[model samples]
Target: MGSRIWKSIAFVAPLSGLALLMGFGEQIDEGACSGTLAFEKSRQLLEERPEVLDIAPGSFRWEGDCRFAMQGYADVATAGAPSRRTFELLVALEPRSHRWQEVSFSMGD
Candidate 1:
């Protein structure tokens, strides 16, 4: 009985360890998306554009490893007037510097 229990533990131990490692990796990826770095980088890039007047608080979602998508409402300049519109930003982490970079941006109704 003791030998059988030992075998079971030996089989389960590596699997549990692997699961924990994977979970930890996922948490890190989520943090990168939800944390300030990704959002701030995206906001900065958007604000730099002349048509983007202002940006509101937005939500961030993980796209994949080191990539994030941010969506929110923005005040965009149209016909020399500011209009509220929805915007989306795709950002990715720079592997060399670990900084977020704007991949793409779009604004729509």
Candidate 2:
């Protein structure tokens, strides 16, 4: 009797926790990769040129209570008008620390 009640409580506790997470999940901005950089505006070029291959090279800092700074570069490669190739990049970072993990990406568009 008591054991069955405890088992039901254990199952209900995790379900409620998952429901809370679904209700208050973080909002992730599309195509935004932040790292440990001083100025975030510097990387605005990443959104401008989506057709080119983007290479993001950067690192992130971790503190005990979720304060950090991140920065990096986004490289874009595109074909030129006269059989030439062009490379464009945006380097950016934020002043305040955000709770995020560093990831390595090798995807192209």
Candidate 3:
């Protein structure tokens, strides 16, 4: 009798927890930054720069209500000599109707 009761309690407890989590799952704000037009704009911006070394898709993520973080690469010119190297690029974006309202770019050493 004791073993049977323990088994029933274990099964029912996990199911009840799962039901609560499903009912009140956290809302991720991925939708606000997503749409067909937004994606097209992003693609265009990525293509315009000839200095870009490479880009990792899906690297852009929301930072807050109107800001985002983007990571990629850009070619950097070395000082005192004629040499070029790839730098880790980090940027922030502010959204404007299907386009970025503001963008700040930087290189990480």
Candidate 4:
């Protein structure tokens, strides 16, 4: 039983890793400085359909250790009350891949 379980784990781990690599690799089409992409992802994570108002110039910058930063404002109706929301966004990306993942998104920060 123990050997069978180990064999299963050995087979599954490589497949799981391969799936992850392919998933990330396939997202290479997402371009750099894609506020729209970030906004769309934020909407999903924030669980609100926020209207991204403006992406401020110079608001986007680089951070240490595979991180990038950006900030903007949007009109979001959270808890059923519409209000202007400020966002401090951080992301990670591969330079050539152009695929990005959100690291953190804070509204009103």
Give me the candidate number with maximum TM-score: 1
Q: What do the candidate models score in CA lDDT, each in turn?
A: 0.82, 0.44, 0.53, 0.63
lDDT of 1 by residue, 1-109 (tens): 9999999999999999999899776554433434577777887888898887888857888788778788999998888668999988999987778778888888888
My TM-score estimates for the predictions, one after another, are: 0.61, 0.29, 0.37, 0.41
**Per-residue lDDT over 7-105 for candidate 3, one digit per residue giving the tens place of the 0 to 100 score:** 999999999999999888886765365534444455456556665434554466565654555555444334554333323222333444444543555
Query: Which stretches of candidate 4 lie above 4 Å from their native place?
Result: 1-58, 79-81, 94-98
lDDT of 4 by residue, 60-87 (tens): 6667555666766656655665667677
**Model 2 ranges off by over 4 Å:** 29-82, 85-109
Query: For every candidate structure, what is the RMSD over all alpha carbons to the true structure, in angstroms?
Result: 8.8, 11.2, 9.5, 12.6
RMSD of 2: 11.2
Clashing pairs in 1: none
Looking at model 4, report the run of 10 residues with the lowest lDDT sum.
49-58
Worst 10 residues of 3 by lDDT: 82-91
lDDT tens digits by residue: candidate 2, 22-108: 888986775354343422332333344465354353654433232333334444544653222223232323325532332222333
**Cα RMSD, model 3:** 9.5
lDDT of 2 at 71: 39
